[model samples]
Target: DFSEGLARVKVGNKWGFIKEEGGVVIPPQFDEVYDFSEGLAVVKIGNKYRYIDKEGGFVFNIEFEWAQSFSGGQARVKFGDKYFEINKEGKIITQGREDLFPVKIGDKYGYIDISFNIRIEPQFDEACDFREDLAAVKIKDKWGYINKEGEIKIKPRFAGCLSFSEGLAAVSEFDKKWGYINKDGKYEIQPKFDMAMDFSGDRAEVKIGLTRYYINRNGEIIKEIIDIEHEEI
Candidate 1:
């Protein structure tokens, strides 16, 4: 898939990058490569992973056992069963968000402030990070939305759900079919897709049976994805 104006392509058994105009930008060499993020991409050579620039130049001399694409100016990497967030200069980030952090006491989960004070008492069966002022929490076996003050904004009814992106969140009901919902606990897009992803920009990716495509906020299919290698030459 194309990301940040470049797409990784496979030639024979090696992976490389190409421009949108179908011109080879980075020759096929790496064993595996991830989509670029924040002007850098993770490339795997042999069993080690490293970051590389658009010109195929190595950004970091140190290699990691596993690495992920950069997001919000940082990327997570694993060395020996431990994951660490690193910056573009390969420096480990120790500080996290100052707002609220998920904390687990016994078997229940809750949120705590940066000063280690319990902001929300641990009561949820499961809790996730807050996004757009709302967090997804599990009560017994159902999922619901909760505000930062621990108020139940949306009742626990969904079988599964994701944090809100843009202005909506993807959720599943008893039928296990995924759909979208607004902040008021109203369905914006009816449940029908076999799987649904959070909206990125103005489009969200969805799957129905064996077909996967992009859908707009209005539940309209905007583009159909076709594998590059599968296209007729």
Candidate 2:
């Protein structure tokens, strides 16, 4: 990600990579270009997949049906109907495409890393992407969480869910209400509200009864969006 400075963006569009300060360095010549991540980005040219360095140099030959932005040294790509990850050399980084999705081998869902590696086993009723080294996994029709090692960090309880952010995750109870959960799956903000969302910039939008408000990370009321005592119009 261009966290600082500007240049001709590493990728291309009509104007290619736009630097942070708004300088065109690489000169976007790519039919499609993505933001730089880990010093590299995915680029496309004439129906080919490849990677490009910050200087706009092609790092590898385009050899995939489709490609996406690189993340953690790899990117999710497709080849002839199957998706996989490829290194900068345009080589399949894994044994095959088995790890590119949450495959339900028999009757469960889980995650797989780029190497066809079972980062999380297929043992959950459902699963979501990993965030903060953790992911939401369902068990017995209830929601929970698991670590990268496939260990259950938080037991299934929520009725609905979302990925973690700013240290909390949205959760819902089967009989109670929806709220946010800490890393331990315990309701940091109890399941008392009618609905809630994860924390964003130290504050989260929350709903109680029929009112919506913003709350700090500590679950303390920060501002009420509709105080009802205020005038509208």
Candidate 3:
């Protein structure tokens, strides 16, 4: 149930939150804001950012170079170009490796535990969020997915990818496009997009030139692209 009536809201000049029915609960005043999680939300004010509570309060008065929303009781926050995990109470309790985050590392990435300990060290060089205890990690440029135990569950072959959603993940292989795959690493849909995005309601977004279109699981174009610069291809 929505305690404040609004699940999301815009506060002032920037987007913040108030709860149900636009109550100005958090005071709309940030460059960007994420939905409330575990009673807290991440907000960016000016160039600096911090987390705020439902009561428009700060949870521990801490800030970081970058941050991920609280997950499994903690969130990954960055400092001085390095990533680490902090508890909900705003305490720095875990530290990530130099290249754990990956996209900026090389071609692989790893995960850390609550104690700032490396659970999965700097590996895949490229990786997406862990889903179903598995994360899509990249190696040498090809993205395969691995489990929390650092075991390669699905071998990397797709060029670009995203984490699993509804037991399927989107993967891309050549300059022409994107497709979907199952948890077992088998193609649910062939790689064939000029551009592609994740699936929502059994429909995924694909692009033709600069226009966007939606396709169903059977690979049928259910929707057409609109307002796109057709020449941008």
For each candidate in the order shown, give its overall lDDT on alpha carbons: 0.87, 0.70, 0.69
Give RMSD to native, each candidate.
15.6, 12.0, 13.3
Locate the minimum summed-lDDT window of 10 residues in model 2: 3-12
Our model 2 lands, by Cα RMSD against the true structure, at: 12.0
Model 1 gets an lDDT of 0.87
Ranking by TM-score: 1, 2, 3
Q: After superposition, how far is residue 141 of candidate 1 from its true place, in Å?
A: 0.5
Q: Which digits, one per residue and each the tens of the lDDT, describe model 1 over residues 8-124?
A: 999999999999988999999999999999999999999989999999999876777889999899889864334667777886664753366566666788886533357899899
Residues 1-233, model 2: lDDT tens digits? 55324343443235377666656777767776666667777667777766778777777644556778777666778743457666655556745322334545457776655543455667777777677777787888788887777888988777888889988998887887877887977777776677788777899888888889898877788899865576786
Candidate 3 global CA lDDT score: 0.69
Tell me the deviation in Å of residue 193 in model 2: 1.5
Candidate of highest lDDT: 1
TM-scores for the candidates: 0.58, 0.55, 0.54
Candidate closest to the true structure, highest TM-score = 1
Off by over 4 Å in 2: 1-103, 226-233
